[model samples]
Target: MSAGLLRNSFKGAASAAPFFPTLLDQIPNAIVIFEADSQQLVYVNPAAESALDLSRKSLEGHNFHDLFGDNLQLGEMIHEVKSGQAPAQRQELLLHSLPGSIHQETIPAHVVIALMDDSDLMLMEWFPIDQQLRTERDERVTQQVEANKELMRNLAHEIKNPLGGIRGAAQLLEFELPEKGLREYTQVIIKESDRLQTLVDRLLAPHRKAHVMEYFNVHEALERVRSLVLAEFPKGLKIVRNYDTSLPDILGDREQLIQAVLNIAHNAAQALSVEIEAGVAQIELRTRVARSVTIAKQRYKLALDLDVIDNGPGIPADIRERIFFPLVSGREGGSGLGLTLAQTFVQQHQGSIACDSKPGCTHFHIQIPYRRQEKSE
Candidate 1:
């Protein structure tokens, strides 16, 4: 994350250290402190500067409410906060004509007013609710994923030890059986043991590979998966590319990422058997740069946003939550390891994946943080 973003995120901690204006300049929210009587702006945070898309030099010493074009509700809230009639607390509403951002979309904010009683200054903080909710959601997701990994690691270890012995015993017994009927029984045992061995090996696959890191174009992996998918579903499956070609090359395991995307696309193709038959199946790979993202409680200024969207029947509602759990498959005869493996591979890159599904739509959103090439100021 940018230093400004970092400072703003920890404003409470920074407040005790000093009263430096630079501390708040890069926050992701619009904060303006003003005199109660004159309504003259005293300070504007960096987030407020960015939100309005104007410099503090241009906005300071101006009426804070005057910058808003026609947001009666927001203006009234500001007036009330300035009056100090009562503590306005937090109010949710829309703001219009934020100076330099007049042509941009309307800004929705959770506005809170605070009284700096000692200085007789009124502090108005306008936070975008979307960013607030997103940070909270990211925190929760991180916690849940950590919990899932711990449980799965323990279970995999437990299942790992027994399979080897079972397979070895079956092979030893098969060589001793001389009668054809008894040998047939031994053969069945050996085959089933081999199948279980393969299954157990897959359960441990995510941990087996050394994460080879190299700077690679993400589209290379996407295109490879696209070709592989097309080769299988040539008749009706359409793979659309919505890429941000301007994105810098990402550092990751190319093979693992290819497998991750392929598994997701393959799953979609399977679900769209009917659509593929009727020539209406469509799967999309979209990419964009995400801002102000929080992964594992760490803030990031830029992250890759890769979305795989399918217009199939969607994931079953009952199993949506467990879609990434090992052995949890919604499809008949499905091994259910694809998504789990994908999640593991992405996590290896210090990134993550999430899914949202409803009938006729399934979205797999993957986020991978860009490693900063230089130290952030």
Candidate 2:
């Protein structure tokens, strides 16, 4: 129906009643209507059902305070709107579901509350705060990735010329050594120089490779990593595959994607050394389809959600935030470039990777859009 007609219906004209429920269901935001007299919910949209993580039948008879907990601010605002002290209002609230609810938790939301004209009913619409936070976090990660790329490229190039000179001089010195035993000193210099060169090469690797995009199954990449890791840790660790067979093929560099996941899974296995020895280490590769996701400031109708989970001692709290930064490592003798390179590869595909760690579980979540570039526009 037209905008004017919808507003008229909200103002107590009964003509819009029959189809308005459908309209509410179509809205992306969570919305619900409440009977003012009893403070009981009368209607709920699908989005509301999903956001509240409950069914309509379970939520419809619950009182406003019950669903929203005993939040004083929310209760006061609803009272003001229902009593006609305010025509409409909005507030950012930490809403909590009742203790008896299936999932009792605090929900951060920007909520709008208003009274229905000439009707003993109230309407509420809310945008989940966590969604906004995720978008903001994605933007920050994108910015950080760009900054890191520029820094690594410049630093690697600056060290490249001197590195070659150091190796060249060491080779000349090896020939001039008076005694054969003295040659060991020059050999040490040469070996160390080669090691440094390898490190620099890795630092510049992301830029050197061409981004060869193609359509491929993501499970192909995961399976490759799973095989490699299992081959390395054959005896103790178990690799579990939780695949959504219905997932569509994604467009990207399949090799780069494999390397990205391999880096993550390899690190997880390494961290599980103690568990591996005890024969209790586990790694899970889970995939699912995510809808209506915003990644790095762009919204995608569909995206690939992949998780790499390990049951190992979590990342050290001190270095968890800096795990993606170059040269920062939690393990002794670790090069610390794995996660950095993994993040770079994912970012190249217009995707983001994140980690959440605790004492027993460390989860690496990666998301990449499923739509092709041309269709993304």
Candidate 3:
């Protein structure tokens, strides 16, 4: 063979040598490749199959349009790429599968498409956004649930025993005291009991109650918490805002949302106390729109993302996962219910909450769906 022809033959073999299999196995993103001429799928990675919740054998030879359906941005992008146009836009699509023998269930999948080409084949990579999000959400929820159970058990033993003793002692003192001062001492006991009861109630609320969903603007709720934090910390802390103006009103109970955001923000503020004393405590409330997020195996059309970020001594790595449990505090006198309650409230909204912490910074990310429709005026 001529040298030039030999070189061309080697290059062609390299192009067809299951290049995608290696890429798909290594990269986290789900990827699919298609033939430019026929628009048929030639390759799918394990991540792609798992994300789509399908088998590789089933997806092979299927056209991109047939797999994703009609009137979708992803389909259009594929067409453009096939027609030799380099499109520079990312398209998000909601994929629903037809009921079939496999699992005999319908699945909602979220995919993002990007077009690339290698040799003569068009590479159409479909990323399963929903699956990734859902997996993370479920893990967090499971961890929180287990932590709350342990917390309730411990708190019941630690708190209720002392509370009972305090109440009994106060009753005895009231009986022995003079009539005028009796009411005053009795009132103190009653008030203290009531406060303790309230705390206990808050701790148990997640286990006893059902989640209620309502419509409210997330930004408004965050703003309320921001103002409250600022008022409390006045001169020491700075509360910064980074909001996505286009985010729609979220579907959640207003009060629950406020408490959830406030709980996380309060923790951030407390972490910044050393910085606050030095006149540089900084906390931020940020909001954004997220696509293709799944919670509890269900995919949402759009989700609200609220991040509470702070610059301080970050959460200790040893207890990072345990922080959401009631009474698992990082501070000397801290009650750990702040994060537990926050998780419960967000979970009630059919949403998810996660935390990532390291030295000098900590961030809590909350994801919930937006209201389906606006109320008419």
Candidate 4:
């Protein structure tokens, strides 16, 4: 090779090397490059590592089919790229992986399989369905939270001012009444005032209380909530427990956990009331162990997975994303603080709560870290 040709060759490789990897890094989606012939991962970006809940060190040299199942559609997409069919557009794929146990995920990906310098490589880029939806969601949630605070403040002031006066008037009327029958009307007014006071109390609970953390068994917390829900909907609903006994104890407040779990289960039971009347309202309490979990941008070695699944009409699309904010309710008589408070409690424990809903199935998945290593006293 001449000196000029040698210089041109070095420039070409340098330009291409930076171009591909830099492009991979800049893209918002998780990108992974695999050697088509060897069926091994060639490169993975930080996003890919986070999406898969695995470190780049663990992902390198691993086959896609081995990490995911061999039968996954992503495997077939890889085959097509290697066979000289360049992917024309982005593809949506559902992936199943058994890291330790079965896990199912739906991923929206854009893939390109091509020959780079006489070597076949498959480039796959994916973003989680939930993460893509979260950008718009977070903005809306911020706005809603502010609006809710103002609304709560104004409503609390408006209601609290007259509540005492109403009770006082009711008491005066009770004393003035000559007969027991007339006193019943005053008693009803007093009861209504008390009910309104209770609602106000619930509305202000999230803002007024401080988070207190302690070590507690998650299963015990779940069972406590389950029994309460079953008792309330005893005639129609069947609450089933599916506990993963291997899950370690988590550090969280027992009362808060009880309230959080009960809120979710109570909402589920109420949603299933109609079905329960027909002898079909079924609520499942499932607990499992999640590994390499990420909650609030932090990773945990072990996490507890608690799922509350109900058989009812799923949440409406318009408000599905806003269900966690204060005063967003699905039911007519519901105050809507239940889910909001539940989410607040869970986040205080450095956990996350997510919901997946369709026509007949609604699942609220809660992920909280478990204490894998105990502190020495």
Candidate 5:
């Protein structure tokens, strides 16, 4: 909100108290108002309650420092603003939580503190930096993935016709060859053409299939992938299921969801070659209901957070950023279409996939909103 707007809203402080609280609650960023002299929190917005993982009833009447712990930088900024050395103060700082709080981890936030006009209250607004960055990255990745899919679809179609003609000509020529030895050249061309045709078909597979939406347990899909991956690496790799059984059944294509998770798990299994040989490779299929998540610039009240975590060497840096791009692979002789197709399937379900990797740890996080189909439709 603009400073002038806030000033006008607080013109008659006593009469506007109720309305002001409702107005502040509507803001997306976390906001807290403190008594200047007492330094005790008097108002906490809904966003603040969610971000802090604490109820406003419990947060109010508590000293700011007692709740968020001591941060010298933030204190300095607040001091400057309160002392009139600055009209307002803004800084990016780590927002710490006290022990025994619901969430004890420090939050990276961009904070702004300002003194309310002609009042003994200081208003503070903060945006969670990590969450903001994740949302932005998800948006950018989704856009890039859509662009890549379109380009690949067009390219695949363009190559498909020529590929068929090449294979047809090779077969026709092979039948008329006078010498059996010369048949090898035609046979090589035919085989290569067939291979390219197969590649093109796989590239267009997701688009060609009709979306079959149905309500099903996400764990069922995970179980399918677990079985498939374990069957392939039964001896060395271990697949662990960490699921929240209370999660409601989500609506989507069961096969597509299964394939997406399978691709991720399969890639993880392949990357754990060394760990598998040592009998320590592990992959975890974890699921939880994410609250108030934003996917591709749209916020959802609840979404599925499906994570595929692997205890193996992380993805190589060279191909990590473009892992979802078709034809980009880190492993030798790899088709590189696994992740691309997986991303496509998830995107079709109005979701996004994110990957984080470092040595000995890799996480593939997939989020899809839960929306029940209209009964009237």
Candidate 6:
């Protein structure tokens, strides 16, 4: 909100007596008023304390410049407002709080500086931009997953019937062949048709599973995947587990969870084949719990956070966005249905999986909400 706009809102706030502070506390954006001569904060609302990671009492007598002087750009902006160089101005800044507060990291924010009319005091408002951008990106990815679901259903149906007919005809012709050489030709057609049939069945597999819900430990699923991966690549790859044992059991299908996690681990293993040969391949399975989280635009009080991190040559940029699609594969002989199936399973449990990759690191984050079965009173 503009300084003038907030000033106007506070015009009759005194009439409300005890509720005046409450009104200022409710504003989401941080608001701070500074004295021109002393260069110290004169009034700071509750929101300012939260956004700046400093309590109002702690900030009351501290010079604004002293607290934020390390940021040269922000200092210049403050000087501009103090000298009345402009009526009001806005700029994006990287802000870090003083050493006193719990938050010690820098945050990107859009800052607004405005002077209160006929007063030496100026109001500076801080608004963080990270969460806003993340929310928008999440919405877009979720919509894309929904659209993919519809396409998979229609595409699978279109291929299944013709695939079965071709396979049946090839089988009938093989039975009628009189000589071994002629039978070999029929065998080729039958074998190829059967292969295509198996591919079609995989495409239809997600919808075929029964979602048998039960309270199951997420670590159990992780362990099952780890054991399977080790069994496949014993000599080269090393699987590390970092699990939070205190996390609550998730309401989900146990076998499906295993398949979902295995696809990701399996993909990572394939990507690290070269590194595995060199004895440098490593994958980590990490689990944690996040509170008051939002997934696919839905809010949950508690959610399970699973990270499958790999030390491999990251996903190729060309097919990164298309990696979750049914037939898109990065590997030479890969069917490319692994990640698609993984996504389908997680989404069925009202969850989301996000992937971030670079040259040395590739991380897939799977977030599923914790929905516990209530105990009998």
What number of clashing residue pairs does each candidate have, in the order they appear?
A: 2, 0, 0, 0, 0, 0
Candidates 1 and 6 compared by TM-score, better number: 6
What order do candidates take by lDDT, descending?
5, 2, 6, 1, 4, 3
> Given candidate 1, what's the lDDT at residue 185?
76
Which tens-of-lDDT digit does each residue in 1-377 have in candidate 1?
Answer: 22333234334344433545555554655677766666666666655665665656677447766666656776676567666666666788876655554236676778887766534566777767787677788667657766876786788788767767876787788778777678777677778877866776787788877887888999888999999999999999899998879889987889999999999999999999999998999999988766555676677766888999999999998888888877889999898889989988988888879898998889999999988554359
Q: Which pairs of residues collide in model 6?
A: none
Candidate 4 residue-wise lDDT, 189-268, digit = tens? 99999988888887777667776666778888888898888888888788888887877778877898889989999998
lDDT of 5 by residue, 1-377 (tens): 33333333333343446566777867778888776777777677666766776666566447778767778998898899989999899889898875556447888889999998645778889988788677777678777877888998999999999889999999999999999999999999999998998899999999899999999989888888998988889898989988989999999999999999999999999999999999999999988766565677777767888999999999999888999999999899899999999999998898988898999999999989998798663
How far in Å is the alpha carbon of 186 misplaced in model 4?
A: 2.4
Each candidate: what lDDT? 0.77, 0.83, 0.70, 0.72, 0.84, 0.79
The candidate scoring highest on TM-score is 5
Q: What is the lDDT of residue 270 in candidate 4?
A: 88
In model 2, where do residues sit more than 4 Å from their true spots?
A: 1-91, 94-106, 113-124, 130-134, 137-141, 373-377
lDDT per residue as tens, model 6, 7-61: 3334434333345345655665777776666655656665566556455556645
Candidate with top lDDT is 5
TM-score for all predictions? Answer: 0.70, 0.76, 0.60, 0.68, 0.77, 0.71
Question: In candidate 4, which residue pairs clash?
Answer: none
What residue runs in model 5 are displaced by over 4 Å at the alpha carbon? 1-70, 74-91, 96-106, 112-125, 130-137
Residues 1-377 of candidate 2 have per-residue lDDT tens digits of 34344444434454666687667766778887777777766676666765675666666447767677678888889888877788998999897765664446778899999887646777899987888777887677667767876888799899889989998998998898889999998898889989989999998998888998889999988999999999999989999999989899999999999999999999999999999999999999998776556677786767888999999999999998778988888889988889999998998898889999998999999999986656554
Candidate 3 local lDDT, 1-377, one digit each (tens):
12222223223443444443554545555666665566666666555554564666666446766655674556677666556565434566665542341223334444444445353455555554565776876687676686666768677658877887888888787878777655796878868887787778777776666556566677888889999989888988999988878777667678888988998888888888899999988998888765545667776656787888899899988888778777788977787789988987887777888898998889898988764756679
Higher-ranked by TM-score: 1 or 2: 2
lDDT of 1 at 105: 64
Task: Report how far residue 290 has shifted in candidate 1, in Å.
Answer: 1.5
* Candidate 4 Cα errors over 4 Å, as ranges: 1-105, 110-136, 178-181, 289-303, 316-322, 369-377
